[model samples]
Target chain A: MSFDVDIEVRRGDRTISCAFKSPRGITVLFGPSGAGKTSVLEALAGIVKPERGHIAVAGRTLFDADQGIDLAPEKRGCGYVFQDSRLFPHRSVRANLLYGWRLQPAERRLIAPELAIGFLGIGHLLDRMPRSLSGGEAQRVAIGRALLSGPQFILMDEPLASLDASRRAEILTLIERIRDELGLPIAYVSHERGEVDRLADTIVPIGLPD
Target chain B: MILSEVEWQIVALSLKVSAVAIFGALPISFVLAWVLARKHFAGKVLLDALVHLPLVVPPVVTGWLLLIVFGNNGPAGRWLEQTFGLQFMFRWTGAALAAAIMALPLMVRAMRLSIEAVDRKLEIAARTLGAGPWRTFFEITLPLAFPGVLAGMVLGFARSIGEFGATITFVSNIPGETRTLPLAIYAALQMPGNEADATRLAVVSVVLSLLALIVSETLARRSMRERGGHVL
Candidate 1:
């Protein structure tokens, strides 16, 4: 199993829960709008404090209610691709890609900067600031930045939801390549059934709790 | 009009005092601004009000308050002098300290506005990509907030250069020591036939202020362009 997670998160008056032990490759979290799908990823990434439960990524305990062990988000080793592509606007594309990679010990860097940039097809944007890029280009850089950081897994939160269909397809293909070639586990969030069908090795349904 | 040696010395002293006050307060202002911008606590409102007190209260009152705390006979003052061999009584350093206190409000406000404008989600994203809290702040948060920091420094400089009430009350108008531009202007105006000296000094003050504002605006625009941030 790539992920073994059973968690509950409280937002306002509502509580959201998900319990899933996902297989290798991508685990699709399928739900409608406001279904708290992103909250589940937040829990897995250690961004949201779970009300109670355990999150184990590849058998490493990220959080456990009974054991009282909760890792900081930085130590959780998650490469989160936010819905809005949170690139460091102050940085050039190449600098953004290297931000985390440089922080990692040379021995801990699993992916080469060149390889990640090449894979994401962002080589041409190395010197350009983020604002000059189109939405699709920016998203690609965001992904590459996370990938180059050498995270143990990736959490993608509706990465294609903002793009046009054609741009969506282009990124979808690139994501598929990341899944097949990089061999990193991914927990992908999406409401579209087509995305779930195309990406899920295991489908985890997330929604507001009763 | 060309400045005499004494006039030049006065200008230099004023610049030095203002520079020390602003630069000395920069890091402390950043921490206070970050706390006020990002933290939550029961006494948050009280802290905010306290930070702004120097701005609201009469500068002479602030100087009096400083005297109570940092006077040579006072606890902090005695400890600082005994431990570090430093004294702020009747010295230019005292003037700098007064100016710093007076300038602090504008500095913190400018920095807080910039920090509040930073998209906090980016910090979260940085953490998810393996950046620890310090790295995320220095790299992501600070860079995005640089323009505001620069603006704050300039505002503090202006305020410090013009700080008279607190400085005079705290350090006294000692020539070649605490007699900065404002104090010098006051001294010039006190004597008969010294109106020319006062006018020239006033002109220098205006030119310095104009230069600071121009430099601040140019740097801010450049930093904003480099950030190119639409998220802000």
Candidate 2:
């Protein structure tokens, strides 16, 4: 029900290191741009391997340098919603959502596609292509796609950065509803403090490395 | 319309040989293109250069190399002749093999460029959604790069149809067997008072090549549009 991370990552000249435990709630990593906030989530999601340290979600060790254990992103079972919503342009909305769900083991499938579609209010968009969707609609689909993958925890990296103010507000409300209704742990990365205040159950401040 | 019955037979044989060559080379070309596009390993440069050698070398040289490696006296040719009873020298199959070898570089180049153009981010996204490497490639990379694949296939087909030097050098100009359109055209030009037959074959070649180009262009544009990409 919690994620524990202690890792150090080096990107060229800069080094990023942090250790924190996120309980069963929305934990927001608030920082300025270029503070490596997204990198932290990427490390947790097994997209970027850490230079050193360990990551565990729900007591499962995803990465441990001492043990020489580093699970692939697919095996880590952590859902990631990128800022750009990286939906497959060649696939319809339903196909994109089912891309992960179809691969999940029957016993491990915690969230059904229907439930995800219902939760995200994207049922009507099932047949449409990702390119035709609005920014907000695409992001919602991205969120639903993540949820349907049966992830142990969700990592969202500035998921609403590309949306307008109105769409942003609408998505924020949807996120709140998801957190309250589904009770899924989320590690949200954002530079905006207002968003952290509204959604974060625990806030981890990130800043430029000394 | 000016083509005689024998000339039409040559045309049909040419089409059949080139079609076989294209389809035969496609799967191998795709695998090679993917390796060239996505993988980095020792000897990669050497492998790439080898794959592209037919493009820069003289077609006669390529044909000579094929003859050296796949001729009746060669190990592979001997083994195939003994084990499989398949001979490539002076055969229609030899013509197809020559055409495929000559056209492979174009197919690989087109497929590699297309594969490279696919967004890596989409692949990473697929991985996060629990798709294994094979699944990601088939479901995401292949579909996204399909337009380029089609373009490559057309280019290969066009090249196979026009293959001359390698085919003639490897298979020799055996009428009704190894003599394709280009060889037939050459044969007509060599005989006295057969200039009209050669001109007819030339026109047919030009029209077929033009049709292939148009079809490739249309397919490429349609693929781009289907993926919501702006047509350039």
Candidate 3:
């Protein structure tokens, strides 16, 4: 299995529990709004700490409460594409895409920047500020940025949730390409039935399955 | 030509004192502001209150405290002088130090608000993309909070320009060395025939404060515009 995760995270008064193991390709955390699906992605990215249990990805133990092992977010080698496209508003698209790429050591750089930029098709939009881009363009740039981060795995939190039908289809195709071509393990968060049906290699229901 | 050389010297010294004070206080204020804005630890309340002591207590009390700590024979004063040949007693640098301390609370408050206003989610995103804490702060948090930082500088500079009680008590009003605009104004007022001189210095002080605010606001707006038009 590429991912073996059984974690309980506390959010306010409510506690969210999730357990899943997935083989390579996309593992979809399917659920409705406020189901704590996004929280799962954050935990995988090491941005949110799980209260208990363990997180093992790609033969590496990221977190194990019993073993007293917890890694920092930056050391986890994750490319997290946030739902809002969280591009640095102060930087150009080119700089945002290269922010992590430049930080990775030459030997650690797994994906070439040119290839990721070509795959995401954000070449023409490179010089533009994030605020000026359309939602779809921003997301594509965000995806490109994540891909070029030289990460071991990618966690996407509902990247298509805010897109139009056409844009959604486009990003869906992009996600499929990333899974099949890049061969990178993906933990994708989504509440869409059609999306899960179309893209999930392994479905981990976050809440009651609809 | 219109003002005497001594009056001009006072204006220049006032500017120099405020400039040094703002520059000296900025990094410390930023670090304190970031911690206050982001961290939760034991004694945080005490730290916050201590930081604002200059703002709440009477200026004369603050001045007396500075004198006690930074006086020639005080522990800190002796050690600094022994270690680095640094002297703060009865000098312009001592006046600058007093102004900086008096300005620190306002500077920290403005910067803390700005840092708090930064989207924490973006910082998280930056971390997930392989940035360490320092890298993320410099690359993302600082740039986004630049406008607030500028505003804080102006607020601190304006306060430093008007610093009187603390500067007078800590450094003493030595002409050409420690006397600033407000001190010059007071000196002129002490003499019966020098109302015109005091008025000129007071007018200059007002103009300087106004200029600092206008320049700070313009720079802040420009920075915000450059970062995509979300003016603070």
Candidate 4:
């Protein structure tokens, strides 16, 4: 599915604007810590309402402030992996992964839960509680949960920030596999240059403001 | 060794009043806790103060206030009595209302802490995953706050079971009707040479309070474990 964004949002004292479209593959929002990368991703996902401009995924208008058509986050058909994983600590990994699927319309595509469990290499973690998962494991489960949502676009904000170097390497490779195999349009937010170089297909640098 | 018929009646009546008070206040307390923890509105401080009014006010004053608004001739009382054919004046219902008011502050405090403790990011994630506002509240927020809700209920139950001053003031000490454990003990202590009866009732109250505390703690721990959260 195609993903397009032309949005301006206020970040603290700054007014940041961005416009881009990705037909397929990963589009990395590469920048420094305070460079408004997460804000852009949040706006696209409908988590943060844009000050102006519009967002459309697969030609479906998700937001247009002028038109007064701002779809709620749930109806945007976007998957988001929060910086902290945000796994439902009360649910098992399997349950967390199945949560989004449970909310889908009955006529939606029937993607098996096992595919996500296997894709993220979290088969063994299905019954494990979120508290039992290590940082890397939790991140993997977060990715799996997002994927199981049948999203047209996936937004991940520093999904590997909590991991060690070796763990980051493992998750990075897995992300590349998800990109090549699933071909889902992905927007990744990160301050680390090394991660961007390793995983990003289209590096959308957070350019200096005028 | 055996509870006399009068003692049994008093015990049953106290339990019934406490149960009704706790059950009645639960939903309103939960909504108030969410509002206090998450929302900011005009006169929020005033609303917060009103919720904790029972805590700082003398129980006698609280009872007097309840009587003013909820007594038979009062506005709310008149409306209720006219529209619903219900009465709260100097009855067991009045005792339950008094207990609920006395226990409300503690319930709100416990629940507010729990609701605040929830990681808001999780709710955001749920939103992105296609759960609407009410659905996210029930599925995610409520389950995560289960431990806190349980604490609030236990605190309310304990507070209600021991409600005295407000209950007496609102409903008076009608044996087997408005008389709860605390009121019963107070009544016994005032009568001529009824020290033994007072002590027995006081021991029962203590035992009941201790049991509720233990149960609350146990359930809190269990909820934490079930959710894979670390006990703090």
Candidate 5:
């Protein structure tokens, strides 16, 4: 699916602007810290509102400042995997994965819970609480949760930045596997050159506002 | 240790009043606490102060206000009596109303603190998962804040049982009707040569309060354990 993004967002005192189209594949937003990478992802997920612009993914308009049409995050159909896995501490891993899946309408559901759990290789940890999982395990569950929500595309904000080297390697391989196997378009945010080289099919560079 | 019928009646009446008050006020308290904790609007400060007004104001004054609003000739009382034939004056229901109003601040305070303590990120996550705002609150916010809710209920129950000044002022000290434990204790103390009866009732109150506290703590701990041992 193609993604079109042309937006200007004001954060604090700075206005960050970007206009780009991403062809189906992994499009990495590469930038240094404080360069509004996360902000862009947040805006796409409808978590943050842009001062001006329109976002259309797969030819469906998610936000349009001119038209006063801004869907809430839940209606955006864009899965988001945060850097820190924000799993509900009260729920088991399986429950967390199903949290989004169960809320989806029958006609809108594209991914099954079993498929997501199997794809992420987290079936064994289904009953375990989020706090008991390691960083890698937790991230895997977070990804599975987002996937099971039947998103049109996925936005991952430096999802590997918090893991150790070995865990990072594991997650990196999983991300590539997800991209190749699922064939889902991904808008990834990262600063690591190695990660970009290994995963990015298109690169959108962001810089600090002058 | 055979207790007189009057003592038994007081204990039963106190329990009934407190139970009714706490349970009846629970839904209202939850909504008020959630609004106080999550929503920001005009007159928010005024609403908050009004909710907590009973906590700071003397109980007698609160009871007096209730009487003014709910008395036979009062506007609300007269309306209710005419429309539904409902009467709160000189009745157990009136005592329960007084207890509920008096306990509301404690209930709201506990639930609000708990609701505030819940991580907003979880709610956001729920939203992303397709849960609407109301569903998110019931499934995520309410369960996470369960411990606080339980504690709040216990505190309200304790306060309701001990409410005397308001109950007396609004409903009067009618035997078998409005004379809850605290009011009974006061009566016992007032009557000459009833020191023993007063001491017995006070002991019962202390015991009930302690039991409520113990139950509250136990429930809180169990809820924490169920939620993966995270402390509130």
Candidate 6:
């Protein structure tokens, strides 16, 4: 599914103006710390209300200022994985993965818990609590939690930022396996060119003057 | 026989009063905690102060305020009497109301801490997971705040069990009507040769407070353990 986003957002004193309408694939948003790449993902997911412009995902109007429409993040069906995994500390790994499925209106949750557990290679860790997992393990679980919801497009905000270099290398392969093998559309945020070059089907470079 | 009867009476009365107080204030505490922890409206500090008024204000003053709002011929009191054949002044219900008011601050404080501690990212994750605002609260925010909610309940229960000043002012120490444990203890102490009864009741109060505190601490520790393990 193709998506379109044309918006301008202000982060502190800096203003970011993005105008892009790309065909659906793995679109990597490359930028430095202050380049407002995460801001773009947030805008798409209906987290940060934009100052101006509209976002249309798969022909559906997710945000339109002139039309007085701004869908809530949940309703937009855009999954987001934070830099820090942000797993529910109160829940076990199984519970965290099943949280989204349980919230689904019975019929909407197409993926079963066993399927999700297998896909994330976390079947062995299902009964384990989030606290017991390694950083890479937690991110893998976080990804499983997000994918279980069966979102239209996934937004990953520097998912590997918290891991060690070796861990990053390992998780990068996992992310690619999820994207390429699963055939899921992704909007990945990263400052590392190597990660972008390896996984990205289309690059939307940010941070530099444009 | 008389001492055992009085002990049972105090136990039953204290339990009843605390239950009613907790039931009355829990929903209000949830809403107020969310507003205080999440919302950024104008005069938020004032709203927070108003919710926590009971903590700073004397229980006697809280009792007096309850009397003013729920006494005979008072607006809420008159409306309730007319609409539901209810009477708060000089009644058990009034003692409950007083206890609830007294305990509200503790409950709100506990709930606010829990709500504030919820990861904003998790809530955002739930939203993207196709859970709406209300769904997100029940499925994500509330569960994540479970440890806090339980702690709040214990705080409210402890506060309510010991409530005396407000109970005395609003409902008085009517035996078997509104004479909760604290009230019973106070009446026992005032009478000639009832020191033993007062002491027994005081010990019971201590036991209950200790139990509540222990449970609260356990829950707090479990929550910390869960979150701490997740951290890098």
DockQ of each: 0.82, 0.77, 0.77, 0.85, 0.68, 0.63
Which residue pairs clash within candidate 3? none
**Positional deviation of B150 in candidate 5, in angstroms?**
1.5
Candidate 5: misplaced stretches above 4 Å? A105-107, B228-232
Task: Give the per-residue lDDT of model 1 (tens digit) for B167-203.
Answer: 8888889999999999999999999999999999999
Q: Over the stretch B99-175, how does candidate 6's per-residue lDDT look in tens digits? A: 89888888888888888877788887778877888888887788778778788989999999999998999999898
As for candidate 2, its clashing pairs are: none
Lowest lDDT 10-residue stretch of candidate 3 chain B: B223-232
Return the top candidate by DockQ.
4
lDDT (Cα, tens digit) per residue for candidate 3, span B105-131: 999998998899898888888998899
lDDT against the true structure, each candidate: 0.90, 0.89, 0.90, 0.87, 0.89, 0.83
RMSD of 5: 1.9
lDDT of 3 by residue, A33-90 (tens): 9888987888888878999999999999999999999999999999898899999889
Q: What is the C-alpha RMSD of each candidate to the true structure, in Å?
A: 1.9, 2.1, 2.3, 1.8, 1.9, 3.0
Please tell me the TM-score of chain A for candidate 3: 0.96
> What are the per-residue Cα lDDT tens digits for candidate 4 across A1-210?
466788899988888888888767888898777778989989988888899999987788999988999999998888798889899998888889999988887665335778778777888888888988899999998888888887877888998899999998898898888788877778889888888788777788886575
Task: For candidate 5, write residues B185-225 as lDDT tens digits.
Answer: 89888979999998899999999999999998898888888
Candidate 1 lDDT over A47-147, as tens digits, reads 98999999999889999999999999999888899899998888888988898798788887778999888888889999999889999999999898888
Candidate 6 CAPRI level: medium
- Runs off by more than 4 Å, candidate 4: A208-210, B228-232
Clashing pairs for predicted structure model 1, backbone only: none
Q: Fnat for model 5?
A: 0.67
lDDT of 5: 0.89
Candidate 2 residues lying further than 4 Å off, grouped into runs, are B229-232
- CAPRI-style grade of the A/B interface in model 2: medium
